[model samples]
Target: MIITVPIELPQEIIEEIVQLTKQRIKEEQSHQTKVNEIPPYPTRKQLKQILKIGDSRLNNWIMNGLKTIPFGKETRFDREDVKQFLNDLKI
Candidate 1:
């Protein structure tokens, strides 16, 4: 003897799943924006002090794209950027 069962998902459940998917996508976008937001600037000395890393190391990070340090032609470090970098380092 073989038993066969028909399985069907309710329309309400499908709608709920679609709504949840959209909500999750929106939340992910918001999170990405927060991550992409640029931090403020810090001086070279201040950055070193805060991150406890040498100038070369920080420069390497910038070069490798692990972090972003925007600067004008004069090349200055943003304090808030360093703070954010430090925060990112936290496990």
Candidate 2:
């Protein structure tokens, strides 16, 4: 024996629900990918290397808008923030 349930929903509403679910699943997958891939704070030198910028340029970026987390003598930057900064610079 098989049981079936029938429900009626507007086509637009169904489409919207499907889209939202897809977006949510994508976000969950993206978060999982980054959850264990990055460190909380990356050192300034490491950031410079990641961005492939010289010291002077890095200083210029820091002055422009890049943010840093200071821990006594060590300065670190959030990897996500750095990526966002670079993304924001795209024309």
Candidate 1 structure quality by residue, lDDT tens digits, 1-91: 2322355778777677777778998986775555444335555565555445797997886775454444665455654554455467668
Model 1 regions more than 4 Å off:
1-7, 40-91
Q: Tell me the whole-model lDDT of each prediction, alpha carbons only.
A: 0.59, 0.72
Encode model 2's per-residue lDDT on 1-91: one tens digit a residue. 2322267877787777777778998986775465335466888777665455788987887898989888889988887777777667778
lDDT of 2: 0.72
Runs of candidate 2 with Cα error greater than 4 angstroms are 1-38
- Least accurate 10 contiguous residues by lDDT in model 1: 1-10
In candidate 1, residue 44 scores what lDDT?
58
The true-structure Cα RMSD of candidate 2 reads: 9.6
- The candidate that achieves the highest TM-score relative to the unseen native structure: 2
